[model samples]
Target: MAAQGDKHKSISGLTPHEFITLNELEQIPEGFLAEHSANQMEYNDAKKKFAEICEDYGKILENGKKSQALEFAFKVIYDIEPEARSIKKVKQDKMWNFIFSSKGNDGESKRKICWIHTDKAVFKHSTNPKEIILTVKLASLLAIETWKMLIEHAQFMKIDKVLLTPSAGAIYSLKDIRFIAARIEGNQRNTTNIQKIINASCQPGGHLLAESNYSCALAAVLASTKDMKNEEVRVQIVSKVVKQYFVARKPLDVDKCRIWCQFAFDGNYRMLNNSDNDVLHKIFKYAQKNAQIIKLREVEF
Candidate 1:
């Protein structure tokens, strides 16, 4: 996060509005890392296997292999984020909830995959958040097609999260946030047109730089202190993260500093004028001198 924040604000005149990893949550024990270590390993294995399948299928699709493309798509779904396994010995055996699903109205499915070029079309409005989330989640798996969907929809979805509750996976957290940044960087690196990359990046929340690993920590903190009345504490915590990021990636470019300032102070001041450069310079200057550790007000210890 520290590294990305520096690089992020250097290139763009905006900072990320959302990004907090599970590790950074004050109350959560560091040992939670040990617990998820196994799950992380499994996820990595699944990601690698899914990538290979997508590559082969991509070749077939390019050759007008419609029949094969559908077949590969189905297989990819089963492989990526499949239903949890049941253990006979474990009474607590239950399916870990999927971050997204795709088993509902065809129209909803199409809307969830709005970015993709497809022949199938739907002319109905979507009313199902559950199905929308599931469909979006399935379309955002590790495969190329899924990754494409993720890149196209991430910003739009981030904006949409303001309308939906956390229960539907609409909250803007670490994994979703980092996925946006990483996928954008990936696309920019591979594509030849610098204009296209810039246009795509300029979408909502494209200015965030931290990696996905930071999401869980941020979400945990928000969950632990939902009733706190101290906005300053929250601001301080966020400032600490931003300061560390800039210090590590020192002397941010003019544009990057602007973006980071926007993300950090998006609503701190009323936007009355177009003079953002002047405003951001002052904010970053303050951050540079006051990069100090912040202690939360509502600590459990």
Candidate 2:
């Protein structure tokens, strides 16, 4: 979105495209927006329809109806966007949604987690739209594993004595939960290269910096935790995952763990280095057996 000349271009403005978050869309120039807005409108309409369907159903891409929906979502966003190298992009891929219950209900289960492989993170709250969080099929699996680890580590730290909430465990809307910045972060230290790669694939953050490149963008679950007094305490998703891992230190049922969302940011993420991708694929094989979920599927959302 830099104010460069109107001539330098690709099929779109940015190479690969943007996820077109609300912030990015707002930053677009009036002239550029009007020129390419029709296509954007079409996509927006499709997104709205998809949102409505997601509202009705508990999950998207259920029973393998993801092909059509994913095709539309995997475009170069708008054809006029530039290489976005100059414009910092902040995006979120809602791999899963939380169903909130106004009155607390004991029946609620833990919120589904969608872990993104962020380059940096903001564990606390900020109106900074540049706080980037993303995930892909591989990252989601890593996220689950990361969550398991979080609960484990956190138990050794604090929150082991915390009580469960009374509601059908709402994922506490983004506005209510306090995001802990990466101040006293877990070392994410690993002994082997594989462990290192997998560990890097997980995080939930504050004023996160962003670039429109391959950093494994994924967010499949809405993760959160509560205290005994039925109040939403500010716990990092990773830390809360840390606490939960101890409480529910069971193995993840890979078959039961499903992510219905596939947010491809203008095909740029596909440009991941082959070596990194190979390592990631191997890591995912150890967890998300449905690792091939990235390719187009018949999703219903």
Candidate 3:
């Protein structure tokens, strides 16, 4: 037992040199060098065996084009990982909750109008970024489609006053709707004539309303009060709408108009006043400075 214990300790503690050394240097064979070549050979054989086992394991996991082996491996992995199962169950519960909770409605009456703020492609100039231009045009098209859908929905629900929120941008001008209506009525395509009509509509005292947050708020109020038939409440709602209409009718000042145009154009002020080259130049300079400031702020963060 003592000899066995000593043997186990030597097996565990022997260094590479001592383990490979011959018991008697004088009894060494004639062709044998002092160094052990068999030790390196054995080590290489063991490494090759390990590499072959890894390759076989990989092949088993990648079994055929159907990926059945991979699926099975993943199933095993998922089974072993308790946290993954918990996360999947949580996700399933959330999905079921969302599906069941969507049944409740606000109980508002169906007789309601919708007002949409029109989107416009503000920066279509050659100098602007292509992505920004594309985004603007896409938003404008989406707004037009949304307006058409809202109008149809309102008509189907037997409601009136599907108001199209106005913008200073020419692309979203009310004149575009009239142009579409005219085309539907078989009017000929005349670019110059259409531009003239749009220009006329944009002049002071025209039907177009100023773009304002108040317009959106008032629209919401009107829609909320549609079912309230109490005489005083009805009178108040009507009065508020009338007041907003008059306020929107007032011609916006130059600075305010430029700001509104900036908002509508997605901060591209260069596209705001195309009629006046000098004003357009000034707006372009301002936009460039503003963009630099924004870029600097981002870099600072």
TM-score per prediction, in order, is 0.27, 0.16, 0.16
Q: Write the per-residue lDDT of candidate 2 for residues 154-188, one digit (tens) a residue.
A: 34343322111111012212121111111112232
lDDT score for residue 55 of model 2: 27
Span of 10 residues, lowest total lDDT, candidate 2: 205-214
What Cα-based lDDT does every candidate model obtain? 0.28, 0.23, 0.27
On a 0 to 100 scale, what is the lDDT of residue 292 in model 1?
34
- Between prediction 1 and prediction 2, the one with superior TM-score is 1
Q: Count the backbone clashes (under 3 Å) in each candidate.
A: 27, 44, 0
Model 1 root mean square deviation, Cα atoms: 17.7
Output the number of the lDDT-best candidate.
Answer: 1
Supply the TM-score for candidate 1: 0.27
CA displacement after TM-score superposition, residue 181 of candidate 2 (Å) = 27
Write the candidate numbers in order of decreasing lDDT: 1, 3, 2
Could you tell me how far off, in angstroms, the CA of residue 262 lies in candidate 3 after the best superposition?
28
Q: What is the lDDT of residue 195 in candidate 3?
A: 27
